[model samples]
Target: MPKGKRTRIVALTRTRKKGLDSKKKLMDDLRSCLEDYERVFVFSVRDMRNAKLKDMRTKWRTSRFFFGKNKVMAIALGRTAEEEQADGLHKLSKALRGQCGLMFTNSAKDDVVDFFGKYVEADYARAGAVATDDVALEEGPLPDFPHSVEPYLRLKLGLKTTLNRGVVTLLKPHIVCRKGERMTPEQTRLLKLMNHPMAEFRVNLVAVWSKDGVVERLNPDADGEEDEEEEGSGAEDDAEDMDSD
Candidate 1:
């Protein structure tokens, strides 16, 4: 039998934050693990989806990921987690300039890199995320919606809707939003109501430190601030390619 809304999966709304002792423990743990691991990869995080990250962490169970304050993580690796990581990990921590994390693993670099490149998934667009595509609500019956939501959608979004046979129907097709624009709150609500996906989250590996004392920038030309389709200066690329072994 089919389940009701009570049995539906729900995402976590709030994440547990670290306290003073927890932060120190993380640094201590990372510092000690630095010696035990052979290869280290620095990854940046943006619009982090904690649940998605937790799932990815589980997938890479063979490796270790440390996400925290860059300075603390840097200090754990050596004298400078911001300027330099370790002797072999020089400039590795510099990639930690923004929201960053450290990945320690004994895994092959090629395999790890390939996995990250192929692992992009659509995420719910949050405030400030650039729209990846045009999202609209067509003139038609909203089958899945309950009849009660008609008023809120009409009043809040300026949507032309009417209740017909206990279902919300749009009077005319309208552009809820356009591409290449910052997501607005009303548009966000409309997207949720219409079940439209407008954002893509992917990891962009900017730099890597291999086991054989080699260091390299994996995506030197990757613009962090620009989407894959857009062209912009690299200086503002404060985006990410987060996590894993």
Candidate 2:
């Protein structure tokens, strides 16, 4: 080792150790969320853009939404879910098969369900998103784009572009994407450029748990109708998926 500038051992964080710590913290926080609310709603999230999620979180002042690794959520609610946390909450934890999150609200379950039913906002589709329908654009002057972007749009993005009156214009009409097609990076970019957002963002409330431990699933077979549950004790939810990551 040099006396003037000696090298010291740099501590490296082990992946397993760091991951375990993070998982533990997430479990603790989620358990706390479960304990705070009279009811917990399990819901699915898709195309969850962080900015929009943040805005929605801000708007819903009375409700708290916690999204995390599904495994962590399941573990936190309980290993068996029934014995560790309040009643029926384990059902929600058990159903954590995909991307999922829990919503803790003091509001009435019916009101929450109705709010979710009517709440839908359009957002840009990202790569890996499935196309719901064909998106076609007609040839026109796209004055929204500046003339400076014409070269990049034409050369890089495979779009026919020309400058007219200090604005960019599309030279031809073409189908941007087709139904059932998996969105590509280029397609996502082009949609954004065309200001055509393709994804519908909304919360699908799958299950709800009461403070007294009643659990009910929002039965989709009945046209998103609520299913009746035997009233009991325990505050638990086991439904839907919310993958925060």
Candidate 3:
């Protein structure tokens, strides 16, 4: 066969892919924000909730928030003095080690601080979340719950319940959860069914970087916060998707 007319087959080989284009774009955007915004803040989220985050995004449409992808964000801010995008950015990057994010804004510092400090949303606790308070059901008629749910409360949830006069009644005092204890899936579900919200989703400012090369540590005690990656919890997977905007 003539070389010009020969058919070619490509061989597939395993090669480690490096430097994701998405990550590069993020780095570029972060660097751009460093120049464009008047201030950058590192904030940590406790009990992350996507709906609340989306609400905040809408409320602060002019500002930018980046969540998840901690390593990429840290690199974008510059991990060291020699490679930092700007003065004091390296210190800000250090705060990115935990379940935290970066906020870039031109808003006044006091306004931003006041808003986040007061912003707290209570949500139903998910499995693996620690209970904030003790939840118990009295040994009596549960008039709030319908009789149809008696079987589910008894068999599925393992709750001691009975249908008495078309009402769900707890045969004995039941403890749903205890304070400072990690809740199980059943416990969380029962709490939700009872219309109890134990998880408090709040964002706390850890550090801040200003355009004037000034870095302020608002939460120095948060240095030891654990990174979510280490736990492999995948708790913020939904939050990561929301970052697409």
Candidate 4:
């Protein structure tokens, strides 16, 4: 081959390698976006082009909360978490396999909690029903994704809230699952239990951090209730001492 032809071939090969390198770098950047975050929230996406999820992600980014796509995140799960997390995290990864949004923050827990509350409030009005399993299984407060269970506040609790309805109402809202169906008794029971305790999403998520957190570990289910009672009793005892003084 001519010297000029050989040079041309070498230049083309370098350009191709550069293109591959650029693609590799992009993937690495996406993965870094996931791994560097302090917490990972895994969610399922029903609609691939979810406008609400996109909006939530944009809102988080505006507030300096980093959001990333899940396919990229799944890669991090595969590479980062232990083999045990692989099954559960991978299941979560599969749930998030399609287009979904993520929010990241190194900010205070309250900030994250506030964000969740706002999101849930926004979506509550528009959502018909949410999956009880999903809500119960979530690490924190229910998401602010619309098309969930905020439409009917009358049926669920046999009570009503002034916020969703008029002052006369004394009920929390009823949630319908996808396809405009009602949640089963078990699901409703779990949701009502969580809601009554004012168990915010972050609180539950924090519980995952301890599997009990503020609640004692011995009895699991019974302990959370007992812990609250103990706190109440302690407060009463403090009040009595103050009265004696």
Q: In model 2, what lDDT does residue 237 have?
A: 23
Residue lDDT tens for model 3, 165-241: 89899999999999999989999999989999988888888888999888998976654367556521342353345
- What local distance difference test score does each model get? 0.68, 0.69, 0.81, 0.34
Q: How does each model score on TM-score?
A: 0.75, 0.75, 0.83, 0.30
Candidate whose TM-score is highest: 3
- How well is each residue in 15-58 modelled by candidate 2, as lDDT tens digits? 33235766676677777877677898877655665565666676
Clash counts per candidate, in order, are: 5, 19, 0, 16
RMSDs, each prediction?
10.9, 7.8, 6.7, 20.8
lDDT of 1 by residue, 137-180 (tens): 77999887788889998998888999988989999998877788
* Clashes by residue pair, model 1: 74-81, 203-241, 204-241, 224-237, 225-237
TM-score of candidate 2 against the unseen true structure: 0.75
Which regions in candidate 2 have their CA more than 4 angstroms from the true location?
Answer: 1-18, 137-140, 164-172, 219-245
**How do the residues 1-245 of candidate 4 rate in per-residue lDDT, one tens digit apiece?**
55764454345445322344433443454446444544444332231223444454555553222123333445544533363222344433433322233333444555665655454312211223444333323222233422234334335544333332222332334432333344555445544544522111221121111111121111122112223222222222221222221
Point to the candidate with the largest lDDT: 3
Which segments of candidate 1 are over 4 A away from where they belong? 1-20, 79-86, 222-245
Question: Which scores higher on lDDT, 2 or 3?
Answer: 3
Better model by TM-score: candidate 3 vs candidate 4: 3
- lDDT of model 1 at residue 107? 84
